[model samples]
Target chain A: MLVSTARLHSVLKTAVDGIIVIDDSGTVLVFNDACVHLFGYERDEVIGKNVSILMSEDDAKSHDAHIKRYLDTGEKRIIGQGREVSGCHKDGSPIPIELSVGEADTSEGHQFIGIIRDLRARKAFEQRVRDLQSNLVVMTRVNALDEMGAAIAHEINQPLTAVMLYLQTAARRMKTLEEQDPQLLSIMTRAVDEADRASKIIQRMRSFVEKQEPQKVGVNLASLIDECVELVMLGHKNDNINVISNFSDHDYNLTVDAIQVQQILVNLIRNACEAIKDCKKQEVYVDVDIAATDVFIKVTDTGPGLCEEVREQLFKAFTGTKRRGLGVGLAISRSIAQNHGGDLFVEPYVKGKGATFVLRLPLGLDGADGQSNLASASMI
Target chain B: MIHVIEDDFSVRDALQHLFTELGASSCTYSDAESFLNFLKQVTAKDCVLVDLHLPGISGVEVIKYLRELSDPPHIVAITGKSLAEINKAFTGIKRPPIVRKPLKEECLLREMDLGTALNSA
Candidate 1:
């Protein structure tokens, strides 16, 4: 069954996407109703005008050249592909559009049919999702900090109490001493050491809890892992879990939001420690390998390996197996990984062995999609 | 005698130093498990200064166990935990005199002496 020209015209007019056909010289030949609605222009007004009128100034300037280049060289730059481009609306505002161009050699001349889809609604929806995700990440951090604050206070107070006692004893001994005694000096030295210990705990806590916008910077992977391990081990001191880390021989510098990456590492390492708590062989192995374009951090535990059932919903939010947490750590960690153009996942479970969680991150922030980076940057 | 039950080695050693400086006999235990094992030697005349956040058997459990004894030792609760947490842990049980961490020597001695006096009464 052959469709008439009138049927094809009607089909183009009723199409959801805007359809516009332009000649090789860049003059708009046919503009359908969808195109009229898309650019706020009538078909009659656009049909005889150059298609450059619907493009931004920069794209408009290169519009004719691009078509001429393809025609002259028979090179298919965008003619056979789709890309996101900026289009100028009738009101002179920029609009994000998905453009796909198809070439046709007709009886009259060369024609390029461009299928354009308005991306305003989609971009707005994406922005909302990103905002919600950012908020959830902050909330997760605050919740974790709240629980950690208690433990930190307990940790810091132990040393603080020791410092106070040591000093008090020294003061009493000094009151009775005829001269400066070596024993009192040793007591004073111990007090100073305890004070330094408490200060270091506060410093680590401050770095973890300080609220800051996400900004990518160069970070040493080995140092970051060591810091996270130390922080996680503070709470698990009595658990007797041994954490061993190995770094591949390479430049360990990578661009990342350090605190955010540390958050993921802390969650992973802590989870590993918790996993091996009940096991006879309690060990957590952290390995960092830098590949050609990406870095991989793997955390392995000697606990009971994950079951098929537990591994299924592992990254889903609010499904934590632990008794205390809201179970959003893995979910938030995965979200952070994806936001960085990376991923977090568990390896295949082996019976009677242990589980390994892998975090893969790009060496550069260029891998992240531009829109999210722009949104995060503007949010600050 | 003042018995110090603390998990941290520094705090345990400092408490021993304080007891020696004050000329009071005292013994220190690293955790609740070890302290409980030595409970057979404790008496009503002795005062126990126990940290609530211990590994293994917890200080609250130790206190409860001591309270169940016919001649329970005088107990002083020493902790870095907040009052609310301490209260929650001691729910429905008689709580001992609570001492906060970064402990003041005077306050701690006062509590220990008060506990011993009450026990011997």
Candidate 2:
């Protein structure tokens, strides 16, 4: 049976959504007005070329693989499901669209009719809503954390200051009375050292909570790891957790935001403390290894590691072990790592053991070196 | 003498220690209403470390009430509230000072404005 030309033309042109028909050879056979406006493609320009002309390089590569399976096996994965695809416009911008393709076998040859829905507006609206929600959450958390930090700092500093003063006075008195008793002098010296350590820890936490812009420097990851461990330990003075570091002597230097490194370390360290809670002997181990290409920061804790159920949605926001946190710490850390072309992950090394989170980064990703690579990759 | 108006007990105790160490007199109040009731029978203090977010009247309102006095204490609005709140509440003063919370001992002394206080004395 043969369909009338009028009926086929009506199906192609009078459809509510955009529809386009192409021959087996990939020449555009028909174009509707919606397709004309949705994309800046005209009938004259598109009627003679390959479909790859309207797709991004990445999209085109996948499309080639997609067609190869269908042409050889006559099997289809997306013909009925309606796949989301990218369509390149006349101005070289890729327009996001959902495509439903139906193959029509006529007496003449094989023709594919494509129905496309433009998704740009819908996606933009969805993205706007997400951004608003994210911004609101960040703003609220930032304010609360800021205020809480301020209170903790102000209130904690007073006694600390008093302690500092008394220690200073005692130190001077002990010096003057050294001939009277050396034991008292030794005791005063010990007191002074303890007070100083306490003060330093408080200062570090106070600074961390306030979150000044990090000291940007070219730092050796191996050395920085040692410093960060000591700082993290200071915050957990009362806890039984012992943080041990295993490192490679190789220079693992990178120009990065140091405060960010400290922030992540603190977060992981805190989590490690929580993980090892109630264990006989709590331990948090850190391994920093620098290979020829990458540097690694692995934080391992003793608490019953990541649960199998939680593993599926592990890195998702709002899923945290702590009741008080927003769970953005790990999420933010992951984003920071990925944005710098690094990777962050919770690695399940052995079953029924402590948890280990690994952060891997390139040796160098800054300034002239990074910019040139990004530019060349973009061009290609 | 100094009055410390703070809600947190630990913070209030901490401030008391700070004032004692500073060689100043101190009276503590958990909220504004209690502080005001005590102030009616007593005279103005030498300084007050007032928290902005109080249970009853705000820290800024307390400052306003002090401003209405014949002799307002050297009002130093020390707040652990947000920078925005402290900035808005404890601003545009020629005498005395505003100290941001997590108060450094040095900031407290600096804000005491000893030079101005001595001239007035």
Question: How would you encode candidate 2's per-residue C-alpha lDDT over A174-249 as one tens digit per residue?
Answer: 5655377778778877886776687667666656654543234565555566666766675678877798888744
DockQ numbers for every candidate?
0.49, 0.06
- Per-residue C-alpha lDDT of model 2 across residues B1-121, encoded as one tens digit per residue: 6777877776677666655544466789999888887665434535666777786698777877777778766777765443433444556744337665445555677777444433433
| iRMSD for every model | 7.4, 8.2
User: Best candidate, DockQ-wise?
Assistant: 1
lDDT of each: 0.78, 0.66
Question: Model 2, stretches more than 4 Å misplaced?
Answer: A1-11, A14-16, A22-28, A37-41, A44-81, A85-97, A103-112, A119-155, A158-380, B1-27, B44-53, B70-85, B92-121
Q: Residue A153 deviation, candidate 1, in Å?
A: 6.5
lDDT of 1: 0.78
Give the CA lDDT, 0 to 100, for residue A238 in model 2: 87
Q: TM-score, chain A, per candidate?
A: 0.46, 0.39
Model 1: per-residue lDDT, tens digit, B1-121?
7788998899899988977776677889999888888888888888899999897898999999888888987889898755445665787888899887767677787788744544443
